[model samples]
Target: MTQKVDTAVVLAAGKGKRLDVFETPKPLLKIGGKSLIVHTLDNLKKAGIKNVFIVIRKGDFVQKRELIDYPLNIEFIEQTSGRRGMLDSMLSLEGKIDKPFYVTVSDLILSHNPYKMFVDCGVAGSADTGALVCFDSRQNKESGANTKVLARDGVIREISSRLPSYNALDLGIYYFSPKAHKSICALAKKDKTISSVPQFFVVYSQKEKIRSVEYSGDAWFDVNIPKTFIRAELYLGEENSAESGESKKERTSLKNLPKTVLLHNKKETVTDITVKRNILERLDEYEVIPSESYNSPHHIIVDESIDSFLGKPILDKLLSLGYKVYKHTVKAGENAKSINSYVKLSEEILNKGIDKKSTIISIGGGSVKDMGGFLASTLYRGIGFISIPTTILSQADAAIALKQGVNGGDGKNLIGSWYAPLKIIVDPATILKLDERWVSDGLAECIKQGFAYDKKLYNLLKGYKGDMKDLDFLESVLKLAIEDKVRTIEEDLHEDKIALVNQYGHEFGHAVEHLSGYAYGHGESVAIGMRVSAELSYILGICDRGVVDAHIELLEKYNLPHQVPKVISPEDILNSLKYNKKYYSGEPRFVLVDKIGSVWRDKTYYTVNCRDEFIKQAVEASYN
Candidate 1:
């Protein structure tokens, strides 16, 4: 049996100089009539903590009266000699704490106990290592980007010092067991002075396994800066009906929270994307199987390569439920996304006797989904289709666009149509099983989406450390990317309406893919294409040189290649772009970004028609 921690240490010594609004200790600042420390203590008590030691600076003894009426067994410790960072604060109780204990910063504002969830995950009981509460850095960029964590399979590989980019930020909440405490102390003893918490963890990870518990709930907020402080005040005030003097304008501020989570009610839309850590747990909601089998039977089109990863579990569930499921495994890869493949797949589905009552389930990457979606649209003049995308690129980019098609002889997606799936189920669990190259392929598309629409989205990718196994982080990224793409598509479902800003890199990306004869994967070409697009925008005097540098910065950050390969000639790329599907008359329209979040829109069309000479120069510049 594993040990359950009952004691905790709260590091509350820091002065609130950065916030500029609070003259008192940051934790003593009142929120909804309760100080931040009071809120933290309440949360610990709720989580069944037995005792808590609050560490403060020497002169901050005046702050003790603030927590005098606290409910838990509270002990106060003053940092007397050589007190430096959080590790020093926690170490002040070295021998006094016998069991594993919870450690959190004092300035965190929470509507719920994240520590409770951390303990429930069995991090304290595990024999391998300890646990740290991590959150998406993309949400609150100020404090979130302070410390970077590199993790794999929920285990921290390294901490402290940014490495190209990182996605999870340590929220300063951790469960350190006796074993970890011993290790951290041993490392600290060798140092001349005290080490910070993240520094200690970085050294400790070299010899031990450290688990990272990613926070998913919406209630967690760190009030370290003025921008976050204002947001926190409004969030807390909105939930507290007990507070009086709330104005109508304050009520309107509630609407500004992420639109998808508006007042906890999802926005109305044509398509729905369900992002979950454990996808199979929510299978029943989609009517995945006919309530009664006498109706139309369902047919499954799965990528054979993923049969072991995602297929077996889903198929097992449907079989256990006693519903008849017919499966057709297609070869996985871009080569499988041909018109011939679509015809053969359609014939197979028809032979299986699938009808309108039966939902067409696609389980694969973009290629597999495209083949299956096209078949679903044409068969019986169209049928219900549900997409279970296995690749990150598919989930983050292709899944929400509702464009289904097969490759024509002239170009990529030349034979596709606008046919949306009834529902999209994104399971990060399956993505964890992909090869790193395949995972990197998805990050490229995710990076493209970031450069085109949302700066936060782009920053998220810039910081993503390729943790295929970090399900919570992946789910958040998928949802963010999906929402961004969905909102863009909804605005211009058909390119005829406006230039699809989401195609920021696809124009040249497709041309490169065609010119290379498919030697480069879709994402690989797109990465290089975006570099060219940014350069072209800069050459045409539409964007600044920094815009070009930002593209290369992100491309190199994700280990994506930006310089066009020597194998593909610039002349070939130009020829291919002319025949590209998105071409009008003879000139191809380009989607260019002037900055991180804004795209340049031409007066006549959503895409600016660039001169051929500028396109050639951009293509030439992309080469090494």
Candidate 2:
């Protein structure tokens, strides 16, 4: 029978010397959007463990804020002594843990199944005094450096930080009773020199019967250093895939799936945009293979910042399926969307032998998509391109657009052409890991689209207010935002028609991005830009008072900035607008909204030529 555990002790006091450059405590490091200890605490809570005891060292105050939302009644014990080892950290909570307790390292990440399995295995055998979770040492190439264990039958015979044996690796998770605690205390007192828990476990195994619970699957990761941390993140992607029941062949087949929004040029359909959560897990489900050649290598161009989140999984899955994969990691963010950056990336693609027939998987936010799409369009004149956008800004805006371009210092999207991807895959799960600020930034576009095109979307933004972390709401917002963008793009196809309504606030948004030297992110800039546009329309007596008020009310509701930053003067904004791409010949033109869900169109043009003095008044009013 499996014994129940009510308490858990988490060892988080390890001095992470290797990751000293980060200056962050190892346990406080974020993985899959949550800190490592939070993951551990969450697993403990899910496994029915009620009380949590976390051990830490001095100056470790950051974790207190991280644990504020955790439901468990947690008690933190500080182990101040440097001489103290893993046993000493647990000894700090000796009297508090009276029941059979779970002990785990905070740096360890495991899925819910393994925690339950480990606990069940820990308590079942009559001869077992305690249980230690172990995995095959060969699972990680650097696992040889970790703690090793030797077990015969179900009992762990030897355990060491550096053992030459071929046994499974110690996973640093244990379930021990009060009796075993007494033995550990006695052994720890006798050997005051021992610091690590694994070393102490080695001595304890010599005297007691400690059972081993072997772990299988990609659900566990020991992230102590940078290398392991990266490996663990990639494994997390794999774990997400493992959880999805769809087989590769079944998932890759597009026959019965819901068709995404289709883009059209004149009478011909250009491409489709597909949005789903965890799409990367079953990437093979889509027909990414080039019709011209099945034998050509596939080149994947990913943003360096998203290497762990998307790059690793894409590489692993493609390699496993026997595809020759060539990768080129562009620098992260807007800076990568440059003429110089494009030249470097394009040359790298050619050097890697990626021909026109090769499918290039572009993985990143908007900036990556812009450069990657441009590169694919230029490579051998044109090549197959598939985009996997991982940021909120990218999902809401970039994924829907056909144009890909690098930034010119004088203006945003100054150098580029229209080149649609063969497929656009948006995974909501991947973007959930993005910082909340960027999510809000993406919502600014949603607000902009709602203001110009769809009142339901506008109403959706106004009512049902919640945090940006709300994925369900975000998913709904993205679908509507994409649909609205799709309709506008299909109508205009080339920014020449009513589709120019899509650039509603982008004129000033790009200017703000330039004038502030990008102090305000694209979303924040657009939010402020939309407000300025509303104010400008109101000043011109073209838009309703209600529309202007709605812009203020909705921008505030979303926590988006409506006021221009103090550093940028009205004159600076006016000067910057002259360089904007929306200018007709010499005069600056702005897309004004007549009301929510309607754009102010002047015959053939959706934008009106605005006077400099009027823009100055609007810019000054924006500060208010």
Candidate 3:
């Protein structure tokens, strides 16, 4: 059984030096359309937190007035020693919270429900003594925050604000039993110079019982700098704007559907002749095909034409390495995703005497990779395949996953396979040659990665100073992007659970792509989808507007589209959503941003059941 917390103490007295807004209290920073304090308050309320004690500076009367009109039940306590810093502010609230309580920073943005964390801590501490929220070490280092904890057999042995080498950082939020609270209070008095919560925790560990509750998902952010400030705003904005009704409908409609594969490829780079050569290379070991005779033979099927340049050179190098090369050229566009194309290519391969022993290499974006992988899977049972993804979309989400398919003319991927690629090679050098529009398209995918799995990636893009076309910068970005995909896929190759996090933008993206008739590239559609997902998550009370806003600002920074085009109707988008691959049993499962690097899939709604009114609102918000 979990212990319920009745009071929450929000530490708001710190004078944020890095934010440079000393004139205004740090908690008052505008995030999305609301103040930071409002976002924090909303999260507490959602978690069933009723009473909140906010510690403020004694002279910050103006800040107090600003928050007086808020809708929640809150008590403001002015700390006489506020200038002494965070530790003193917390100590000031010693006896104000009589019941079990939560302590958190007012400036931190929470993606997960903080109250839930508090409750989990209480439950865990029921047997132990105290529980503190601990986040991943990678996340802490990226944010330049500090945390220290040591545990044994689910019981914290020694918790420190300063450890030799710590893997988890204290999240500045904690659940305290009366006994633990008293111990902390005593530590505060003993260490008068201690300035942070972690330091006090270090002291209490020696005199009282304590344990660390590890938080696995995206839940916390310290918006202490200008960059993080903007990030918080963008995250909140997107959360507040996603389509809720449509997402529910899609989820409900997909409940009874069978899991199937869909394949799509570019027609511009593949032709009947190239297909003929591929078949011949497989069937006749002695026959050799001339690569030069095939038009666009070496042009990889990526989203941008620039990929062809990067791929052609790489193919030449592979050939130089003594590997036999086969070339295929298909016309560019979603129209290439037909049964006719699949059958025609299959017949050509069969005629050429190709068999299961042959290896297939895909060089393109998600479409080409899907088609190529599918063809490889169906030909002669199954064959080895490799993917050389040239677009950011494929590199991050679709590159290494063990799924591929082609969309039928009915606006859905109708045929495919669960074939994993042997390897996926991504070279951002190719992105430098892309047109600005395509670059923006790629940025959408990169941003989606940030939203679903890597806060460092998110912050890197937020602070990016060079041109998007800088090969060096793009290479570095691509490397980081690829690492995120690799990490996720390596942990969950079949997308059983961990990989679901990778779907952060695709739930909404596929619908937008279907409605747009592939006019927009996959990356562009994904950008819009991410924004919609964020908005829906906020409306459903899963996240705050600040998180949504952070997503929007990042999308806007890259000039990615956020709104669906008027040419596509809400009903059309909804209808197209019926084909979402995540649809389970009649419910279209939506992957929403719970916070930066975290995604949630809720199955309560029907697949393809998005309400018309909500879809309209989402489309309208996108334009705004």
Candidate 4:
């Protein structure tokens, strides 16, 4: 049972010293075509928060009131402390919030489900004392704004305003239950003047409970600087474009895909499964097929069981069309994702007298596609390959992205490439045989895509209630995921600029998977990576804590790991990052969120050149 929260307190009273808005409150600065304070208010309303408390400076009350005219009940309080801090504004709200309440900074633009996050924390008692939203610190350019938390078994032990090193940076957003409110008030009385929320939490944690809730799938922006404001605008434009049903054109110059036919035998299957078969058949008829003289020879790759069901008929059709077909299959599991398997497959292709013009068809999950795609890309200096994804995870997420090599002796996908396939043929009808765990794995990637690219996709997942194993729902998810990936790839065909956003989770993921020795699946490692990246983003001041919490929520909802595995120490993980391909000139560059649907790329906003100690602290904070 989750506790319900109805009230929201937005702390907006800070002097705009950093923003150079000495004439006006910082919250009044424009972001994404709206005032920053109004953006916060609108987000709170969107999260279903009814009552709002806006703490403002004494003189700016008139201007603040003029900025927003809403029907929902709103209270305006003035901070009497001259040139005081966040703690002072929060102290002013003392005793006023009688019910469970959420507190956040006014200068942040967040696309998060705050109501759900608060209610979930309330019900789980995840924050017995109080819950602070923690964001990844690596993505931010600004430091020292994050509050570091240390916890064990869901119970927070210590929260430090001046953490020597930490992972989770406290985003100003908080959920305070009645008990927490009492504790905060008591602390305020004892301290007399409140200066920082992190400091308040540190004092409050000594006496009562203080917990942290990680948020996933939300985009948060702190518009304190000019570049961040620009980023916020760009993000808003992207969001608007997505909402308006704008479709980006796909990239060309790759070899054309071959003609494909869907031959399904009479078997017990759902109507949606049949519909999917019809869709594939229709696509074959409508889309243009490549000329064999110019294109590579098409090979028929299928799972052994699927081959038994539909392979013979398809192979016969291709033969009738004067095309030579080669069949390939591999035993399933992580073992299939090996260079050895790829070598054997390559040898088999050569044995068949296949040349550079021969195409390799990959019909399986991510592992099979990854191995086969790598083989085709590297052999004979690159050949054409098509994906026929059978599993939900592959069809929806993994198949759409570029394929890399399999995990080698050191870790998972330790060796790989950025080779895009000629085409990806998604036959969602095959999702019927997927296990629940596989479906969950697929959702993990889907959730990640939603976090990095589309808020509507995130909302769809948030509202989803059917079992993940349901073929129909999984199929729909696959379509959305594919579209998302295609949009990203089209914008960044060579992954030069925009495509870096797609690597959101891979940075931390690679390190974790390497240290785990490939015990965890790609999706699992990515889930943890997403959380760590979000925390790092907050620490670097690229995004707000609320956005970090939103990212955590998506991961948690899908049963993904929010913390790094205990076996891998922070130092080891930090060491592995140095070798990441994204590292530039001795600095580990990060693709961090500027807002939802928008990412800060290398040489765009700010550079990340922190020392090893800072990196260690960030990794440790993510684990806690």
Candidate 5:
């Protein structure tokens, strides 16, 4: 924004043969009572550009006559060069452009002036700093002649329309530097047939930095396409009506409540990821990670507590690499995962110009990871997600699975969905720095896993007597828990059936955690929930009394709670259970255990209906 360029080149050279229906040249086509070319001029004027160059086919007298009455300085150049692609259009500009200038393909219909946005993004005077305007194609599943950009750190690495697994689509717009125009002509002449603009950029970017700037809003469409022509008409008809109000609505949050979407099953990607070994090593593959924006496929979600600066070290390294980073912090703990929290953070990043092709990296314990996953899944309908589980609770359980959600209204994780992360980074150094209490809070999940599915894992935890501060020792315990967990969660990534065993303690535990106002840590609540599950199992004759005693003995041995605090009544816990996401037909369903190391399943599902009275009794039995 510090520098301003007043000139623009509008490419109107393409023939109207593709639309076959249009007898007029593509730029002469009419929409909303004005010619399409006029709209382009109006947009440029709004962006503060004064000089305009209209590139056309060599002898198009009619196209030139139609625009003769417009006010700006109009120079019509006859483009008589290669393939009629962007390089060919700009080749006609030749010596006329020797300064940084804006360029448009002329067929685009836009709701906002992109020129102003680019000018405001701090334009550089050099040729190599050229920027391309683009949006995440995956958001609307666009298909057509739109150019696809496959990039890293916001730099265009390769560009083409047929690319597989591409993240963004170029909007037929560009900002060319003074040096770039001459260099592009030289490259095009050397290749002879290098007609596509993106092709030129593909080769150009290898030697210099060509950025892909993310832009998304309503109605930025290629008018040359037939369907979009109709869509634009419909857009014009609805332009000033109340029904069309959304056209001007800011595009930061895509929808009101985050819709439940299933992301492509994670490829278990980026296995090379790790933490606390050497921070700088990550720069070898990834440069910039922005939370919830495609322009940044990389970002960090950290706990920004006064005393706890979890991801700061990682953020510092990313900043040093020249990655464009935005910090929108949330307080620590359970209350942090809420509808209000999600809206606040996402809007801040989106307002900061986060594009949909971004990858969001969340750094914290369970709560931050949970909220980060939700933000990643919902922003622009799902971006790449990475988790750095800094605590035992996250590393052992929360980080390994694909479930991502935040608390909704009154229930825990009532509004949520399954979103796979690119990778879940387990940092032993972070674990080494965790408080002993937090270490115990995470070990409880290991015990729950052992009692519900893996008896050997439970026995391993029961027998460990090493100091929690011993990284080598605690990591051994964590490794066993994670391995045992992966064995169950991998087959049922969404926890549709047998994987529901993962929630063995989460049913009552979630409600208890909420009702106690999170006075108890997540694992502590689960420990009590496990005790309740065992007691209910015993009452139902599913397990013997010895099984219940062993559950309490093992939990107490690990320093986790086997009983609920007396301050919270059983009635409050039952009241909160009504909001649990797993309930059906107004009945609270729970995963019951027939014995240690196993989950009791009904005829079909892993959860069973529990009477409120029985649940209350079980809750009381766990009360201290």
Candidate 6:
């Protein structure tokens, strides 16, 4: 008897778009004398698997009706994630399975039993990888429809159907732990483009690990691939020219760097702003200065709001130092994030002879960072970008973030880049002139972040007695908030669903900001949205009345609005949600917190869908 796993999952939820000629679902297609999924079941039986969960779509009754009498303990899971293919089928098993189990696609037909060795060779006690699978390929011809891989020392470096160069073929079989499932689920939530297993592994290999088991046997082939279909239908595995690919040069993952570069003085302190830091000193320290830039004028992208206090003086100082400088003052508010503003600024900068080798220093707060960083990442393919955050919210948020973009007509920042600046300069003197509202605006973001990940940060904010004028207090908040944010991002370098926790009030908040006709401040809308989220959480019975009260208490402390403006209708906010950038499958997903210190995360879903009735009630309740 083969080794047995008590549980196994069979994925059969694909549309089989290429096999449209056959009226039956691909899993029901007969190979030899049996259906495709039955062949998988027979193999599992031989491997001693007792329980099987087959994932199929909502109306896939034929699969259930056909397998009703199977001896194995079979339960069909209906995939309700809008028919997104194999990826969604896996996600449909969320909270349904908790242990490491065997997995295979229904169309993966095998004549000879490889399951004994597969279950026996399970990966354990390895911190580098939590999942194990096999690889083999007949690399004689251009059979590229199947998943390809490039692995070294039994570790998968790259695996994708779109891989231009690869050495092995994915066996379409896996031993997946709960950790592996979470990685796949998170990538699906954040990025919808990953439909196939290989595409996900390509991204998964970026920060996590995957171990490749050698499978040189001639027993298996996928039915979806046309070339393999003929072999599976006619000869089965009798004539599979299975060959282990030639070993390529061993290359390790040593080139990968941290997505964000947080440079600060190494010494511990209550406030680092008192510690000396400068823009020029950082430029030399990071060596972003190009050889051709000695005579070339470096660009300074400044917002009109700070052009007098900070922008013009910085430009004058550069001129006094005999350094070439080019100052471009963009519109200061939300309008600056408009596509018109971005196009106009780009045209002006290009006309001013900004080249690939030039360094562009971005100054001012949030909108300025959005515009300047987007331009820098796209200009001349890419150029040197230095960030100077001038507000407390942005200081804690940090310009070292990977996402950058300007606004679109339909939504806020619909067009954006998953790119970051080369360096960041933080000088406290820039924030000294900030108005009280600007200070409040900055504090709102830090407060949101604190509630999501760090209770210490929330405690810090709750106990504050002084006004926003306290520089040391501001520095302490920034340090704590930035540290927590960076730690969360480091675990998920792709910033997939894991980082979405920090966006506690963004769903309803973004919609409110858009529908408010630009009259409501970004911070004001977010404050109101936080209240809405808390209300929604209370309605859902996820949190008690105390959590909601504490949420409102903090917002009111900084002169922030906790009640929605009567001018904005709840219906408008509901309709505007689909236009928001984070809309999941056209449904309004809210990130709700059960309490002060943690966000309500359902497995990989940091933001979850809510009924229109509940969302409307929350928004209406917050209205004055």
Q: Against the hidden reference, what TM-scores do the models get? A: 0.55, 0.56, 0.51, 0.53, 0.54, 0.56
**What lDDT is reached at residue 252 by model 1?**
63
Candidate 1 lDDT over 515-581, as tens digits, reads 8888878888899999999988776555789989989998887677898887777777877886666
Off by over 4 Å in 5: 1-298, 306-309
Q: Write the per-residue lDDT of candidate 3 for residues 1-624, one digit (tens) a residue.
A: 455666677888877776653235678876665677887888788787778888887777876798787776888888887545666766777777656777777777766775675455455326334555564665433344555666655456655666776555666767776667776677778867765566666666676556666665564567776445544544554465554356766777776767588566632221111111122113233212233322212212333343356545555655654555555655555554567767776666565555444656666667777877888778777765667665556665566567788887655566777776655555554444457987788777778888877888889899998787776666566667767766776666666566766666677788888777677788888888888777766653456789889988999899888876777776776677677777643435566666787664322221122234444556556655
Using TM-score as the measure, name the better of candidate 2 and candidate 4.
2
| Cand. 3 Cα-lDDT | 0.64
Error of 6 at 11 (Å): 32
Error of 6 at 33 (Å): 36
Superior candidate under TM-score, 3 versus 6: 6
Candidate 2 pairs with clashing backbones: 85-195, 86-195, 251-285, 252-284, 252-285
lDDT of 5 by residue, 1-624 (tens): 245688899988888565544457889887766888898899898887889999888889998899898889899988886374678877778888777788887776777677766755555343345555555454223215467777677677778777776767777778888778888889987897676788888788878788766664555667765545644644554464544567546654566776699578645533323434333336435533433343353556677762244566577666776666565567788766888988888887677655657767787888888999999889888877878777788888888777888887687888887877876667666766677788889888888888888887777777778775677766776777777667777677678577887888888888878887788899988988899988877654456788889888888887888887787787888788888767755667778787788887533457656456667778887775
Superposition error at 349 for model 6 (Å) = 0.5
lDDT of 6 by residue, 168-200 (tens): 777677766677887788888889877777778
Give the top-scoring candidate (TM-score): 2
lDDT of each: 0.75, 0.77, 0.64, 0.67, 0.74, 0.72
Rank by TM-score, descending?
2, 6, 1, 5, 4, 3
For residue 235, model 3's alpha carbon misses the true position, in angstroms, by 28
How well does candidate 2 match the true structure in TM-score terms? 0.56
Which is better, 1 or 4, measured by lDDT? 1
Question: Whole-model lDDT, candidate 6?
Answer: 0.72
